[model samples]
Target: MFAKLKQRWQDTRTIMKLSLDAEQRALREGQQHPGAEHYTLAALDLPDGSARRVFARIGADPEAYRAALANRHTAALSAIGLAAANANVTPAGASSAADGLAPPAEPTLLFDAQPSGQTLMQSLPELQRRLPAPLCGAHVLLAAAAMAHSAAGRAFKAIDIDLQALGSAAEAELRAAIPS
Candidate 1:
């Protein structure tokens, strides 16, 4: 029982770390809440780089997906008559009705975990069951990719990446990392 509790505590800590990382991405993108997209970015930036390898293995460009995410945010702001002043490129020239958004918000270092974070937290047990053990970036991304209606899914669609291919690649990465 104590061992089980200890493992759960470790898992919780891991999830919290991922959430903090995702939240940083959200705040940097001027996103109100950290969702699957932010999580996807965080996963790609994970020190292990496991998620990134999946993209490379599949002959895909994670950088392009990152750009698409930026575009996604810019388009979102554009749709609301707001443009990101620091956006990489404006798809639509500034409209007379458009207003520029302020630079990315300051970090609060607080926990207001959102759905994608929650999804990652909830998925730990299932992930441990299916993958080797001790969750990593690949697991976080796999969860985001599995979300049928998430921003990550949309970004993949925008980048022309097949979701099944991504998921399969991520799974293979995890399995490959397991000690022989």
Candidate 2:
């Protein structure tokens, strides 16, 4: 039981480290408030007596993990873009959307929390809108942290599933069956 717990702790830390790297990239690229890489925060679970080491010690099958991360990162960015795009879309039959509705407000992006629980420096307009409403006022700043973690989890799981089904042809077969 202790061994299982230890492995879980290690896994969580690995994921966190990867997410941190991604966030840094966003910042370096001039993302004033780089959005969270993951949509959920993972709770660490270090086991009692577990050996301590620098967070960088964990690995994710290197090649497979990187490819998978790339795939998910692309998808996540696409999703965020899509969400941004949707903001531009007229609320459908709601002509008021053209000039009203606050123009969807630029999503102020920023992590909701930090590794040390410190509040983020600032929030981006784009990221600020997608946040959970209830969390906005009190936890808006912390939203990025939670979202970053969630995004990482989602990206990793989604990419792993896609890689697993590669070349299966099941998607093509399904598409062929659909009516144009």
Candidate 1, clashing residue pairs?
none
Using lDDT as the measure, which candidate wins? 1
Local accuracy of candidate 2 as per-residue lDDT tens digits, 71-160? 554455577674323334321112223444333234333343333233222342233243212111112223322333444334435444
lDDT of model 2 at position 3: 61
User: TM-score of predicted model 2?
Assistant: 0.26
Candidate 1 C-alpha lDDT tens digits along 1-180: 986677678667766677777776665554556777777777777777788888898888877888887788778877888856754333221222222443355445566656765675577568778886556788876787688677788888898888888888888888887544
Best by TM-score: 1
User: lDDT per prediction?
Assistant: 0.70, 0.32
How well does candidate 2 score on lDDT at residue 170? 21
Off by over 4 Å in 2: 1-23, 28-30, 34-60, 76-149, 159-180
Instruction: Provide the RMSD of all predictions against the true structure, rounded to 1 decimal.
Output: 5.9, 19.0
